[model samples]
Target: MMDSNDTPVDVRLSLRVNGQMRQLDVPPNVVLLDALRDRLGLTGTKKGCDHGQCGACTVLVNGEAINSCLALAVVHDGDDITTVEGLAGEADLSPLQAAFLEHDAYQCGYCTPGQLMSATELLSNRKVGTTDAEVAEAMSGNICRCGAYKNILSAIQETRQQHAGAAID
Candidate 1:
């Protein structure tokens, strides 16, 4: 029975979320996703299998996506965090978002946020290319219950093509 105003000491969380600095007070047992959604109110990171079996709790820690549910909010102090909600900016969708829309990459969208986070990490890496096998390997961790794997890869490939074309021009 935790009551309000009980030990009102502010816990410090020095982290970069979506390129912004954030310092928050959270309980010791609070998982990263819980703190992000419940405290920071960033809900793009979903919770599918709170045990990390599913990749629905993905978010980037310093550009590398992680399963936030498996991490305590306290452990991530002074780290960078990027949720699916942080992917876009200035009223514009990310290239990945645009490609997902163009290729109908998702169905129901429960797993979409995780897929997006994984895809964002993959695309951010300069080594990943437009190969189907490559995309499959990269996204193997994310499970789309809707089974939209083919469409997901297609959208990723399309985004790579667009990026390549832009780079060439």
Candidate 2:
């Protein structure tokens, strides 16, 4: 049936967000970032550059880091999506979050959520090395307008070292 006055068809997506399964009927054109924020009320994932040029909307899709703004909600059916809210424990902060606070990795705090999510993936993937330059290059997609690159790098490195040390114990 073709009609000029018809609205776009809404597709049902079953997404596991922050360890909870959620069902949503969203339009095919709805971006993952909008779905997470507008529909699920997970506002921790910031919307910086909607075009994916900025990494403010970064989130973990099945443990891989991706820009939420660039992904369509309909395409992520049955996928695991982790926002910044998922990074912390029920009573305490994750190691990375704690490191960010200890290292003062943020200035304005607007980009911190995306920065944390991206850092979590980077640390877990073993793609980033134990160097400041490597961390910077790996995190290049995230843009912190306050220019807290040094502190962010420190937090990532420290968290990595902590995990490495824990592995030995």
Candidate 3:
């Protein structure tokens, strides 16, 4: 509906989430995090601080990681968004997810989803080198108060190596 000034009264957003199309009619003020969790029931994307600084609401928008809480859902219309839940296929875990488990990267697991999302983006981009310091710096945005940085770095590094090996095979 348009108002007197020819402005839209309601906004309809459509996005491709995890290779699936989703539609939502939300107000322009609704944030992407809220729409993903509250509207779409994709709760894997946590809302730790609700502020962009926390990085708990990290998600991939068009293959790039972004803090969903800081982006409006309306702005992401027509974008391809991927959450943590979409990282794995129906019967398998993503390499990063498996590596996190094998490396015991999470403690309390509150930040695991965000960590996985960030790492997924990083690994897919292949811009971050296969080094502890490089992985740590790339993953610095996602904070794990549990202080499991070593294990997290290990997981990311291992996954990178595994993917590289698979590519070679």
Candidate 4:
């Protein structure tokens, strides 16, 4: 329906973003990436291809990774969204974040946020194998133009090992 200006009215969305409740009034067509970055001021989720192919707009929706650019804001009402900014604590980075830093998993850093989000989901999923090939396949959607795949894989493996060891102990 059109408002007084003859423009489509915005829809209200309630989202749990980065552990905090957020409310946004956006046009029904607004993608989740735009809602997060443009409306919520969470710019870490990049808008790369804007098409779902690049995965640059990946974010965790209810603990699963999804291309935010492909999701409509209205459909995800009350969903828990985690941007790259939400991965860390008040003083320290998440283990995966630290591993990424220690392994130098990023170059240029534009795709890092999406990469991190994807890796986070992958690590938590028990079905995905720990082999390098497995990890690469799992992360295929996120394209790091800088070709930092080697380091990204290394970081993921290292974090997996660390977590495994911790679990054993």
What is the C-alpha lDDT profile of model 3 across 1-169, one tens digit per residue? 7789977676997999999999999878899999999999999999999888878899999999999999999999999999998988889998899999999999999899999999888776677777778888888899999998899998888888777788779
Give lDDT per model, in order: 0.86, 0.92, 0.90, 0.93
lDDT of 3 at 42: 97
Model 2 agreement with the true structure over 12-35: per-residue lDDT tens digits: 989999999999998889999999
Can you tell me which runs of candidate 1 are displaced by over 4 Å? 1-10, 127-130, 164-169
TM-score of predicted structure 2: 0.95
Deviation (Å) of 147 in candidate 1: 1.0
Model 4: which ten-residue window has the lowest total lDDT?
159-168
Clashing pairs in 4: none
In terms of lDDT, which candidate is strongest?
Answer: 4
Off by over 4 Å in 3: 1-8
The clash numbers for all candidates, in the given order, read 0, 0, 0, 0
| TM-score to true structure, per model | 0.87, 0.95, 0.92, 0.95
Any residue pairs clashing in model 2, and if so which? none
